[model samples]
Target chain A: MKDVFKPEFVKLELEATTREEVLRELVDLLPVGDDKKELIYQRLLERENLGTTGIGKGIAIPHSRTLALKDVFVIVGRSKKGVDFNALDGKPVHLFFLIVAPPYDPKNRYLITLGKIAEISRELTRKKEWMEIEKKEEFVKFLNGLLREKK
Target chain B: MNKQLLFLISLQELDILIKEKEKEEEMGFPIKPCEELKKAREKIIEKIDAHLMRRYERLSERYGNPVVPVVDGICQGCYMLLPTSLISQKAKNERIHTCPNCGRFLYWVDD
Candidate 1:
């Protein structure tokens, strides 16, 4: 419902080869202090340990609600070579959607944003060019279009 | 950043994640079991002070999140402007703060 996803948050080139590194790399995109960023990454790792957010296919959604953030934010990252995230289907993860939310989300933006991401993920399988999109704007536009198609 | 305050912060983080997972379940998404989360919460609760625990519970019942971050001298819980004196503390996080307007425990986000 909210256009929390931005082209600035999208990175076409992710250098991490492992799950931990990928999550850390995504957290680096946040515009916050170093200490706050570390707290968000730690909370993210805890969530990943509990269960893989990789709903299978080349996607992984690493998320957490932490006191470190003041609002809901989402970062979209992609790796040319997939990283092992201990996904549900035991496949390498090429795309990452990291969602970090403030502990006290009055409008429940985090959950709504998450639900929107899941909806887009479901439509990902049919779109083969998801990873092929070059420009960040084009990539984000394509993703936003997927959500629009749902309606 | 005392031991009790540290534990309380971590406890609140765990609780938020647990609540998120529960919300996910209601939205028809499958989530991991909550039993493990409950165990972790119990472990943290055991480490916090008894009196602090009661205060946290009482505040949580009053405000969904008993612990919140102070961003630029504003209480994120109730959006009330915190006193500048408290904000200018040399060692703010050394002791937890309660918002005068909302009474929720506040930690400095800048630190």
Candidate 2:
């Protein structure tokens, strides 16, 4: 699979009212079949039960792994009004990046995705521009622009 | 030398020196020894303080905690299983992995 991140993975104009709802909606958007969908959803729910995914600063990345996938998928969401996600800072979350990958892969592609998101997150967290971005299309375009700039 | 022991000793020494300096100043003595002790205390404190500060910063950047362990594909820091796609990509060494649920940098620790 290519390492490139595409804009299609970005979901603009999300209507998810809560974090869990957002995760479920994002999972539904993936191309996986029904048999795998439950497994993926279960993993995501289990992961959340362990701890709150809110990393503070209005961003949350909800992810899960399952054996039913052949490749990685990323879903980006933006909530202009922010959702109460129980963030460490007790602030609402405005951005989300959901990652889903297959289990039993030899290369550990999950780690790379973690690193990439962390890199982008660090930059986005520092910039005031990201906080001001209200439109979903603008948010997706900004993320795509960041990915392109990385190259 | 054992690092843990050294750290404990340094902390103890600092506390004692600070107390002695306080006593000397209270007595209105020459205060020269107190000054020397204060200087030494500052040096050690500076080194240790900087080390701890940097460690916390990195921890916050990576796992949002000083020590994070992944158990069964879950980040102990944030308790997110990480994304399956990220796991596959990271397995290939194509990118560094992070938990999408928490946005904390993920690491595979062999424990």
Candidate 3:
């Protein structure tokens, strides 16, 4: 999971104003071309159609299990000005965990990775640490420390 | 994107959305716009060649996905190793091509 959140893939400051824009911004970070990016965006929207992935506490985990993905990947985006994501808590979302994984991931690693992100989010929310991180390295280091502590 | 590619991709997206909606229904969550989406899907089907649409539907009924991505000369749907000749030719031609092993319609996308 630590390797999944590469510094290059992290957006410390998001410029998206809406849920769809945020999703597009995150998908743009992936190492894929235009058509695949479009497909990924469509899959994300389809997942959102089922139900909002914004689980609350200013965190939104927008994910898709799709054949378009070659492997499990994570892209983190932070928005100082929160976007309206139709979250369960009826609040805006500032932290986004965009996860993409293959449809037939053998170990179901996406679920486990998602759980880890959610756990980290819960702890960060409790300490208001997610709000204070300003650099991508800081975000990565904080999450790494949390994962180590959880063990 | 070419018109054919665009059409096929839209159909694939629609089919996946329909399946997801059905799954949600199974989980007791009422899906929205399913009927409207289905009707729209029918219109897209009509836009496709009658013969090709029929083939896609028949295969879809059997495999759940008639169209799949060709990743690195391999059919992601069936995991069959495709011929380099076929893969290279498909890249040159944007039209639909079915995997020889699984008969699933395949499209090429960058990895």
- Candidate 1, A1-151: lDDT as tens digits: 5555699898999999999999989999999978778778888897787777888888888888887777888999999899999988899999999999887677988888888788788778567698888999998888888877775
User: Which candidate tops lDDT?
Assistant: 1
Model 2 lDDT, full chain set: 0.57
Candidate 2, position A61, lDDT: 66
Clashing pairs in 1: B1-B94
Candidate 3 regions off by >4 Å? A147-151, B2-50, B90-93
- Summing lDDT over every window of 10 consecutive residues in candidate 2 chain B, give the lowest-scoring window: B1-10
Tens-place lDDT per residue, model 2, A30-89, is: 786664565567666645543455667877767655544556788877777788876667
Kindly report which residue stretches of model 1 are placed more than 4 angstroms away from their true locations once superposed: B1-3, B26-30
Backbone clash total for model 2 is 33
lDDT of 1 by residue, B3-106 (tens): 67668888888877776787776544455688987987898899999999999999878876888888878888888888888888877888977899888888
Task: Provide the TM-score for each candidate, comma-separated.
Answer: 0.91, 0.52, 0.77
State the iRMSD of every prediction, in order shown. Answer: 2.1, 23.0, 4.7
Q: Residue A99 in candidate 1 has what lDDT?
A: 91
Fnat per model, in the order given? 0.33, 0.00, 0.10
